[model samples]
Target: MKPKTSALTIAAIAIVLSYLLILAIQQYPTIYRRHVDPNSETEKLPYQTYLATFLLFTFDELVKGNFTGTILKLKELNQTYVPTSLKYIFERFRQLLNELTLKLDDTDSQLDYAEHLIYSGREDDAINPLKVAGYNLAESNITYSQLKSSAEEFTKSFMLPRTQFFQKIDSIQNLIENMYIRLQALLERIEFQKNLEETYLEIQVYPENVWVGSTITVEGKLYTRTQPLTQKNVILYFDGQKISETRTSSNGLFNYTIKVPYTYKPKANIIAKYLPVEDDSNKYKPTTSNTVQISLLYITPKVEAKVLGKPLPGKHFTLEGKVYAERILPYNQIKVSWLTSSITTQLENGTFKLTLKVPETISDGKYILKAEAPPSKIFAPTSTTLYVNVQRIPINLTL
Candidate 1:
């Protein structure tokens, strides 16, 4: 009886162990879903862990200067539903990142502006933009430090190791520092250049008004701070064309005589420029004198005429005259006209003599005679009038 009872006890113990093993196998899927499955609704990992992990990855991208990737990650994080406990941290991080982006963009924009101004030969104007960039960079540095500190604290709150995160922050900080140093150096160089002496060129032109083919004298001085700059080459430009080049004397005086070209315009501009070269290029800046305007005039011939002894009308009379001008007139004819008769004669050595016959039927009176020189390409038209005594053939019926 004792042996049979012991067997029954062993059999019951075996049956109980089998039932317990089957139950454990049946609950394996639920246990796995709760603790290990990432897609499970009831995940056991805290929400802060996921937030911290995502931030770490985003920071890694930023450290590599992958701004686009960092922005995408940030957008992804922002779109997700955040827990109430981590909402402030996420929002603060976003604000800090936005500020950092703005500051960096502003700094880059200002640097680009400075570069453009420098390339355009406005170095002095570039200084302002460079200064603005410097200010932005400084502010960016401060913001970056705040961002780094916030990230470190947020990660530390979750017991996350921050060695890698701190390294990324340090790298970004080093880049900013390098940029700042380079900008400061460039600013200092520009300021030094601004401190150099300024150069001035002054000019005076003689005989501001002249006819075509005439010469005018251009004189000027090149100096700095009232001190003369001798032996410098001065270039003279007339009507935007390079006409002549001259050198300054011991007293910084430069003189050039250039002939006025035949231009259709009534006025022409002349400018004197001094461009330093070789070693002197660094000592003085290039300068140009104030523009000098020259009045261009055509040669006007003066027609002087006289009637010999005031001849009577309707009779032959001699008209003598000369065409006086600054230049010799071309072999052109002069026209002499009376009330009813006209004659044309060539100018002989700028002088002309004409015989005119008054109308035989005219009454005795004082008449006018006119001599005119036609216009030419270089000479203007001119005319002269003289009064003549006209008598009707001295009619004397008694004689």
Candidate 2:
């Protein structure tokens, strides 16, 4: 009775251990599924390491004479394990590739055995399995070499280069996309600014009525949105010709003096215009001032001089002249010059008279006298010449 009790107790312990092992096996799939975190690097655990651990655990249980526990451990491995790396999958594929010839031989042996059984008069048993075996052998005729060549060609043509190029293109696509976005924005802004034009310019000329061959002052200011525009070029045009150019000062002031050509038209058109400099931001377009009209005129004068009652040398006489223009008015302070001496006189009623003394060196012969009136502010130059005869004085002496 004592030995039997001890044996039953030992049997009870063994049953408990077997139950615990089965329970652990049932829980493994849940445990593995829950513990694998796809986001974590540790989830890339090497499959070989997992397989070795399972094998070592099974070996330990087998060494302890736990056959049931080992069997349960192997089942858990079969159910819950999955290979992750393409390297491992490709290795297993090669291994299966090596087994193809053995499978074909096995099919051939089955067909031969079926033929033998048919000859032995077991036709019913041979017919079904033989048909299946023959069908499988026909389909599996594709050789290992052919499969390997196809896989290598696919890798060379499609898989390897596609993978490398896709990775490199992923890096460059971000920069290209950013540049495209910025350029699109700039183009949109430029399109909106194509139809705007604005500017402010004012021009003036001193003495709007002018004469030919006379100087006139050109003054102007350039403004943009009520602000002074400095260092800008301004040009003056007269009768459709460029006459003078100047740059604006710090205060946006520009001035030029131009002499009206003598050949200008009766009415002259003058303009002051501004041109934007290169490399400058021309937010406002080039601008021009309003046109200014000026009237042109010419003034010319003439004069004549004569010596009256010049009969003897070293004698006093009268020299007279008249200065007149096309429309004779009171000509005041007309200049009269002769030889190295000059005198100023007024045209009294379009005529002028003055006293003159002939030089004592005169010698009873023909002589010439010239008088000139130089150009003045409003009149051109004029001159005249006169000829006269002088006689030597007779002298008496007593001894």
Candidate 3:
């Protein structure tokens, strides 16, 4: 049987719990400061110890104490019922991660919007806040079944639970979801602001660009985010492939070098990356450069041929020529031919000698004198064409 709660009873408990949660969150930071303070004495040490002891039980107890406090509240409220143990913590943690994933996704989208608005010179006209409000209403991560289960247990302990278990859980979960949504939105905005503040990309590499299988000097100039006067460290990567490494000078300057090597494969890629670090060398990040593509080619064989010439018809003539390869073939392996009116040649060894009978057709025209080699031989095809006025040449030929 379910009990009914009056408005007055519910309000008192909510106000008390809400106040406690807020106070706990507010005090946790001061508690953290005392412990982390290097120079603090006895008083600070005790507070630090106390805070440490509380967090020793759970990690979340350190961060705004949301998970620990929620667990404690549930334990106290359900004390009369058998408490769920180690198994329950795992279940809740899984559920928390699931809820957080949705929240983080929402945060990412909202951050994108905020970034666009801020950069677009529309700060005054930004609808981010309004849009977030609408988004919160549309998507609350809390489930009614979960709320009902919790509420039924909670209501069983109290005398008057006026609203149904489902409604009560819905209302409280709605409030929690709204706070989570708002927190996520705020964090995203803060990130956007941080990015805006450090807007310039102060990175330089000597020989600013490089070809694949080449090396270039790299230097960096970046202001430290936390330590302004001190220079930051820089690390670089090639698509996460470790490349060159170097540290920036104390004057906010860094220089180093890296090279891309040629691989036996047909193609390869080169990429640049920038990673910045502080005084703490162990703390570093690797950023990627735009990818560069490289390609290679193969070599071909070389060939050359040697050839000879001829004379006109009806002319007293003698001709001689030679055909040879720069790369000497051990055998007489070339084929040669003569073209013209009344032209003939004799091939012996690698040379040709010719005589012309001077036919009537041998006047004023062009003729192709040809010499060719077979496939088994390595010589390229060779030819020469001559324009001749055979009538002007009716009397003479030379060797």
Candidate 4:
């Protein structure tokens, strides 16, 4: 029985020792891996693998035009220690990114310059900038293709499948092609505009001197180098303000009669302009006629006076009259004078009324009463006279 027990105990001890040996064998690899030097060649494989993966992610981000994300990733990658074997690859990527960034900036600047030229009405000058932009985009596209090929080769070296980065490149290429097509179309349009004929406008104003509120004739003709432009619209400007619009007749002549606006200036400027519209906008360039100036005359108010009845001495009497003119007088008062007696009264709606009294000491007689409108900036002074008879109050005497 003791031999049997000893043999069993030896078998149990052998089983425990074998289990401990297997456990130690498994733990030895973990402990060794944990203690491996991070900078050693053995650890370089995983580090390079991580770098390659991160580079692919950054490449994809750049292809997607995620500049902000690409920059952040590039910063992180820069901080990482690159192995000597991959330094040239990183340098190439850095150079490619820098070139692409510069190309993009150049393209943006050219586009801005072209837009500014267009807004400044220099479409002819804008074409060069647009062409430069297109060239820059084309160069960028070539650079992008090179970058894509390099990335594809790097991806394949890692035995990785083609990613959406390739698809993004295709999209960017398509966009660039579309931009080129649009630029070509714009250039064609500019060339067409450059070929369009210039327009000439001739105008004459009748009655060089006119009163305010009076009509004056504005006649003009629109023509090109070869022939007149009939049925075209012509606009007339009075003192820099648009006053009337007319269409050219069969002879390419337009006539517009516009009333002179009431103004305090001594003279006004008249101009005729022809602006192309609809199909004409593509056919002809806009033009303006010579500036014509005309003298502005003020209207003289005609004054007429009448007494309501024979006025008794020392009694009030009504003197009323209508003031006629080409325009209403801005002034509100009219002056009346009668043999050393004078009064100023209000005028309403081109007419005036006044209350006057004859001196009691004056003997009864016939006298001339006058009504006058004082001269103003926009009204000429005028006066009219009326024969007025004055008498004393009748006296009844008791004897």
**Highest TM-score scorer:** 4
Give per-residue lDDT, candidate 4, residue 277: 81
Count of steric clashes across candidates, in order: 4, 0, 12, 0
Candidate 2 local lDDT, 295-358, one digit each (tens): 8776767777777885576777788878778765434666655445777776677688877666
Query: lDDT of each model, Cα atoms only?
Result: 0.76, 0.60, 0.43, 0.75
Per residue, candidate 4 scores C-alpha lDDT tens digits across 1-399 of 999999999999999999999987773322235667655633232254576577667767755556567767766766776456756665566567657756765666777677545532357788888988888888988887777777665455434446654665566566556656766766765666577787888889989998887889988888988999999988888998988889999879888899888775688999887777899878886677888999998876788878896798887888889888877677888888888878888888878887788777878889899888887766767899987888876889999
TM-score of 3: 0.26
Question: 1 or 4: which has the higher TM-score?
Answer: 4
| RMSD of candidates 1 onward, in order | 29.5, 48.0, 33.4, 27.4
Can you rank all candidates by TM-score, best first? Answer: 4, 1, 2, 3
Residue 232 accuracy (lDDT) in model 2: 84
Model 2's TM-score against the true structure: 0.29
Cα displacement (angstroms), candidate 2, residue 258, comes to: 5.7
TM-score of each: 0.38, 0.29, 0.26, 0.39
Q: Which ten residues in a row have the lowest lDDT in candidate 4?
A: 39-48
lDDT of 1 at 107: 68
RMSD value for candidate 2: 48.0
Clashes of 1: 4
Error of 2 at 185 (Å): 49
Q: What is the lDDT of residue 34 in candidate 1?
A: 50
